[model samples]
Target: MASIAIAQTQQAQATTSAPSAAAAAAPAMQLEPTSVIVLDSGGGSIKAGWAHDSQPTIMGNCITRPRSARRTFVGNELDQWGDLSGLYYGYPTQKGFIVNWELQNKIWDHVLSSSVLEVNNFAETSLVLTEPLFNFPAIQSAMREVAFEEHGFQSLLHTTAPELSAYQQRVDSPSAQEAQVVVDSGFSSTYVVPFVQGQMLPSCATRIDVGGKVLTNYLKDVLSYRQINLMEETHVVNEMKEKACYVATDLQHELEKAKQRPSSNTISVDYVLPDYTTIMKGFVRAPVARTGPANMSSDEQLVKLNNERFSVPELLFHPSDVGIKQTGIPELIGLVVESLEEAAQYYAYQNVVLTGGNARFSGFQARM
Candidate 1:
């Protein structure tokens, strides 16, 4: 989780230079914690809440139109729509960068005006918004204009999410060394960022093109080829991936185990497909003894999963499996650590941190 901190400036600049001794000694501007709002926007979701709150309110970062209804829903509004199957999704971000401001603006308006954040007057609230690392200067300028001119915020602080994560670590462990490496795997891509003395080394940062979005799409394609066609059911497929998929600690061992007969294979299981009426979301069916098809219900649809559960997540470890031509995350982290100064390498390796939605995969830490 990212940490919230108050800045002395109204419009905080992204800089690497340290403050002068006199400036550092001066008292900083104070603001009530309740008056500040922290918004951590990412390609997959947007996390927002008051600065004093322990947890941020998370919501999807897209606008959707359900197949059953003609009305469109923004952000968290999709929860109200019972039928999530075959929903049409419009995302404001692509490859971890915001590209469609028109769609993004609508989602932002809904989040700020609705009960999620409930900002009655932007002028009275200070905004602490997070942006992607290595963001374009034009996008940064546009964000400032939107915050000050469009939203009329009294003050604004722009920072990256990884920086906040590193800051939080420092706060949690004050005795720990300052050198650390943050592995951020999100919707569109994964980044290995190294921070030294609370500052990031942008030139040494590495990026991998695979993330949760790619994994979900890969699972969709594989399932479509093997069983039912789920080309338009991206939402349903994503839910299924989250509930069933897991990282493999030993790829070869797991593969050999998965090749066994379904009756004896521990990795093999059936995923119950949602019918929208009885089940809103798909679930992993409990293991059952069956000799033939007669034991299964005719009305229920089950997708038999075996090697796919581990093979899909394997792409993160070896993109070459899909011909992406990039090194896996573990090797990339090693390369990043070696590229740093000799003195910082040891501490960086010792303080490595895994974050983002994709990091929640089972056995992810063990695999790393």
Candidate 2:
């Protein structure tokens, strides 16, 4: 929370400094991004911001929950921003895209009602709202209607966040004028978008619905299967993944090392189980007495078990092992390149820029 607060403060400071800096340096500056908006409607987050900035000003979703001031629907109401109630809160997107209309409207309403968006401040602003590629016409029409009729904005524009990231990269690298591949590993899915001279290659661009959520769920399942019993409790399992889990470069070799005897290789984790007793963590089908003498084989089994938990998440890269036919990041990148015109593949590679939450996965960029 402190880190978030600090970052927000820095962003506020930057926002204030930009206008003054621009005014002081006006003579040298020609055309600037000046007034632009960018929106990313990924599964887990809905981020809106000015284009020249690296971060978002407004980030929320269509999901609602019981908040402090309200019984339900905290996300829709603006009055409860600082005093959000302690109830269920969530975004409208389920897998990666918007499915619920009421929730979407509520989120949009809350955004418009924000103090930053007050009528006196930004009435004639240029707006940009992102949508999924090949978005349904009905959703598009509804979006347009809401922005024009409800918000009363003068200018409106639409584009994909991944495309904009690609544009930013292209602008930075002028030589990337050929076919390009963009891998947007966002919250909902990893999208492989191929482009030829800035035009989308609709047929070759594919979306795979495996991502962070899948990784978390997979970790939960592995821990549960090892008798850790995380089904009723996800907090510790989530913590273990966030704090300890890592993808191994070589699975078989790592497994062999993890199978070693527990003298120097294994360490115990103290967990207060449902019974509220501090017990050393190990791989056991049933909980053993913490007060009892330590056993050697049990410790070895525990180490192997933890290794399996760590390795299982690697299945996302090669889903064929689990019978899912979706392509992984590197394969998808090649596919995107292939889908473009023959001359454009190299250009696309040079301009390929990755964005979205999933891009932060360890080794994701290297693998791509």
Candidate 3:
């Protein structure tokens, strides 16, 4: 599971770097050339644009939470007050739902009015924004209000991020019988979606409270346990995970190697922090060092790559370890298949398809 996520992350990076490639490959997905805008606003970031395109046209997190409303974007310009403050500083749909009308209004205002976008003529734009699966009706109503009334957006198509991504993947796949599962590992949670014959099985869908943010926090805790004072070093820790972390195929065997003396098989890392050239790159010494705390001595410590961080994320597979009584994924899949009463037409064993950001994880493919 971790491997696939890493691959997806790398692919996302590649897509961002190569816009022309994305644009050229857009038509293969059979998406309508209606200036389609697919928007995904999670708890951590926002991804917005056409579904067929290789990437979002504009990708930027609404960083308003960390800044005051008066903080002007146009140079530290003076003469800022209340009403203008709210207008200038774009709003965000924090806590993973678009509940506040004012914030949604601000978001629409920013997206439409930004100098980078000339989308004032909303009728020409086929807008697609993300919404949670079990989204509250009030929030849905508010979003509709914002689209039609506030933004004058006539063609609004709201879908969940996972669902739309699933749609794209399903459409892209070779045949309709390719049974695939869509796992979305986002900011606040992870969703495992089962698709058979291009349709999603809602009851079989499962969620885990694990994500990049959760893994980051877990790594933070492990480093803290090692007495690493990282009150201001969150970014460094994140970089380390991105560079060095990997899930062990055989946990016990890897743990044994990590138990060996540092000179033998252990990973020795030299985190060269912050000279500010693309964030400090962490290097793992070829001939491992016999240094640092005794607690960091075990092979298990280094073998897992993420230490407890990897295990904590793995808890999604074994929720019982974390006190969640829900069945793990394989069992869940079986249950889901059983529950699909219309299974005569579809073969769960043969046509299983797995696609999604989270579905890219290392062990995910094999496990499914």
TM-score of each: 0.90, 0.70, 0.69
Q: What is the lDDT of residue 312 in candidate 2?
A: 47
Candidate lDDT scores, in order, read 0.77, 0.53, 0.50
Q: Which regions of candidate 1 deviate over 4 angstroms?
A: 1-29, 287-296
Choose the strongest candidate by TM-score.
1
Residue-level error in angstroms, candidate 3, position 277? 7.7
- Candidate 1 accuracy as TM-score: 0.90
Task: Output candidate 2 Cα RMSD.
Answer: 8.8
Tell me the tens digit of each residue's lDDT in model 3 across 124-180.
565566676667889878777877876676566555654555444444444433555
Ranking by lDDT: 1, 2, 3
What is residue 366's positional error in candidate 3, in angstroms? 4.2
Over the stretch 1-368, how does candidate 2's per-residue lDDT look in tens digits? 00000011112222322221212323322323444344455665566555466555545464544333444543335334443222344566666666786777776665555543333334545456677877778878887887788766655555565555555445446654465566776556677777666556667888777765566667767667866556644333443454455556566766776666554334223232322122322123321223333533332323124474445456556766556688767677776677666676667666666666555445445444
Model 2 residue 123 distance off true place after TM-score fit, in angstroms: 3.2
* Whole-structure CA lDDT of model 1: 0.77
